[model samples]
Target: MNRQQKGWQQLFLFSLLPLFLAIFGASGWLWWNWAISPAQLNAAKPQQIQIPPGTATQQIGTKLEQAGLIRSKIAWDLLARYISSQKSNGGFQAGTYELSANQPLNEIAQTIWDGKVIQVSFTIPEGWSLRQMADYFQKEKGWFSSQDFIDAASQIDRKKYPWLPADIPFLEGFLFPETYQVTKERITPQAVVQLMLERFEKTALPVYQKSQNQELNQPKFTLKQWVTLASIVEKEAVVQKERPRIAGVFVSRLLKGMKLESDPTVEYAFGIRQTPDKPLTFAQVRKPSPYNTYATPGLPPTPIAAPALESLKAVLNPESTEYLFFVARYDGTHVFSRTLPEHEAAVVKIRRERQR
Candidate 1:
């Protein structure tokens, strides 16, 4: 071992140390950025990325990378494999996801792995019928078939939902109207119906049950009858403040054993909607359907449409009034009258005004 040879060996080792240090620094930086850093630090908006059914993990990683939601596909693959190894049921769920570029690679991977897909929302307006809701779902494009929804609503599972009236013909007014949020996995007709019914049980049914014993100075109605009357009010009353007034008139008529003569009932009987241009014709009102209040003295067989909470409440607590008849003014209000002659005069005046 000469001094010269030892010096040469030391120099060689020192040169190798710099090369090793450089490699180590580069690897650490890549790993840190790939695993923990976001693609965009200040990204404000999220991008919608859809992972179709049966999409492979690698494919999903590629999608996230292309959508600029993650920094690297390789990092995603490694993290996904590690996550899959930890869980017994290990796979990414298929659906649309709202992912932001500001999210770290691991957080985004966990979201997809946990099946936290984006929720889609749909709204059913007040007084909408089952057919209308079915049509809406069909028009929404990817939710469900209209016939499927109709079939689901028609087939009532009493065992599952014992609160429903046994003899109620169909679930016309029971499906509570509201905005519902659902994941792609729950887009089936049965799921949607179940949600609405459950919402009714939670929101609407409780209202009826709470008022079951209270005497509102009105006619005592069964659950079916209450819903039926509420549906009528929902359709007839365009003005929010007129709900109780309109309900009171109907209550007065019902108590006196007189026909309700509700125009909505006539429309419901014939399954036709009347417009200002074409009101209910005499012949249509004369049609002998059990639903026609014009021909029938009592309430209809079933609810004509779904009633809102306000309308249902209006029925439960109707305003005490002497008015027995009312007519729409084509505006969002009505003219109430105590006698048929007064109602006729109001109708004549409204007609003349329309003509002018």
Candidate 2:
């Protein structure tokens, strides 16, 4: 071959050699880390991994490896350094980091830079017991057990809660229903229950003050007594529009020295797992428990469940009426009555409809 041609060929070969080497090296490195490396950890979507504040670069890499974000801490650090990237050292941040192995390295780094965290929210329904609320977290959020929540609440004496049930154990209806914003980390069943209880107090305490004002006029109602009655009304009226009327019914029943034959009392007594649409049998209704209205005349020891704002308002501003009986129609509204004859007629209608 001519000298000029040979020179040109050599230059072309040298240039191609560097290009091939770079491609092969990068491919080898990617394979070795992503697939050829030791056992890797997988990240589920929406799973948050925490990165503590002010974490060093080495520590960040170590955490990423530990969290299964990358195969090796050294490998990630080396790559970060190799790319002439400004975010050298750890190149990632700390403080509850959420990343996935499936995400590209650049994206994962950006996630760290963005300081993403997982937030969980709990919406406690009206009249839910502390135990039930705890179970909700365990089942829904994988937080903890109902028993653990009960144990924590049990440490706080209900007796200290002046507006709570006199013969009760721990917090129950006092946990108000509301939407809560909670962090995934440092979140326990106890914390959520405590927050609900705090909210309940905020709502109930003002009503207690009004009851005190009534006592000033006639000296009959006490704060604790008022809350006890309010809780009964809270569970009885499933419909917001009928809450005040239902509260009036309960008040009328109390004043007339009649039995507060509330089925929610029995249903609540059954607890979170066993509530049913059907009413208790005569034998079941006659069960010997302080909670059984058929057997005992007074208010149940504690509220059946957490009360909503409207239910609380029903107790506070009860409609002035003579309603003494109420029955659920099961369409979320109720059948209310005043006289015994009216109540029986309503009951008969309900029973016939139920049979159908």
Candidate 3:
């Protein structure tokens, strides 16, 4: 070949090389911008999207893009691929997620991948005493001290809760029994108490007002007193259907000036329980204390436990009956009687069956 022709060919190749390099560099910059930049460049508000269970990573990217939470589906797909390559089992989780438009593609991918869901749950069972509720959190969750919870619940500002009674003696009957949720990291003893109290205010206030309008409360006793009675009934009634009946028996005894004779009140007054599910001793029953119904003429000064909705309603509208006494049967139910002789006979029958 001629020298002039070879020189021209070399110049042409060199010129093409710079053009290819410039094109490659521009492409690299664009890719980098897509990878690191927020999906919605000017988006300042947050958005919510639910990534359903078993959703593939590609679908998640598509959903995010469609929801305006992510900029590019290709970028998100690549980011998820990179994350999956780094971990043994890495993928988005199934949950309702709060994502912001300003969140970068990589950050969004990492959040769904880690499954940093935000809820912490705790349950207070029906008929759990304040102490029992405290003990439950301490023993099961290991979250806080029992006494701390008690103090926090009692000392919260009553003014903040207009529905809560001003003269409410303690937080015993007011901490409603229900499942509560809070931010996982923000779950504290005080937070739990506040949550429970708020739940009580929201749920119990209407019931309290209804009972008052119906004159369901005992004639001489105030709302708090009725609540106290309901608390006692709560601990005594093992079966759900028996709450109103048990409340009736107590009401009858109270009207006739008879001692309540409730074993749970004695246990609460003396703070003696061999086991959570055991019967009380004769000596424990006879112990003299203000809280002990056998020693006191009226309801205890304060509620002994957290009464559920059923217990509260039972006190407001007790079953009308002539029964004045009751004894526990083998099936964790009570056998009611109108007279001492009938009660004794029922007790004997229960004892014989238990012995058998």
Give each model a TM-score: 0.79, 0.66, 0.68
Stronger candidate by lDDT (2 vs 3): 3
Local error of candidate 2 at 42, Å?
17
User: lDDT per residue, candidate 3, 178-276, as tens digits?
Assistant: 987765544677888888888877787688776666644455447677778988999889899999999999988989989898878888888776442
Which pairs of residues have clashing backbones in candidate 3?
39-71
- Rank list by lDDT: 1, 3, 2
- RMSD in angstroms, candidate 3? 12.4
State the lDDT of candidate 1 residue by residue for 38-79, as single tens digits. Answer: 546665488788899999999998887777776678888888
Q: Which candidate ranks first by lDDT, i.e. highest?
A: 1
Error of 1 at 149 (Å): 1.4
Candidate 3's displacement at residue 94, Å, is: 22
Residue 150 lDDT (model 1): 94
Which candidate model has the greater TM-score, 2 or 3?
3
lDDT of 1: 0.88
lDDT score for residue 208 of model 3: 76
Model 2, 280-319: lDDT tens digits are 7777777777777777887777666677777766666778
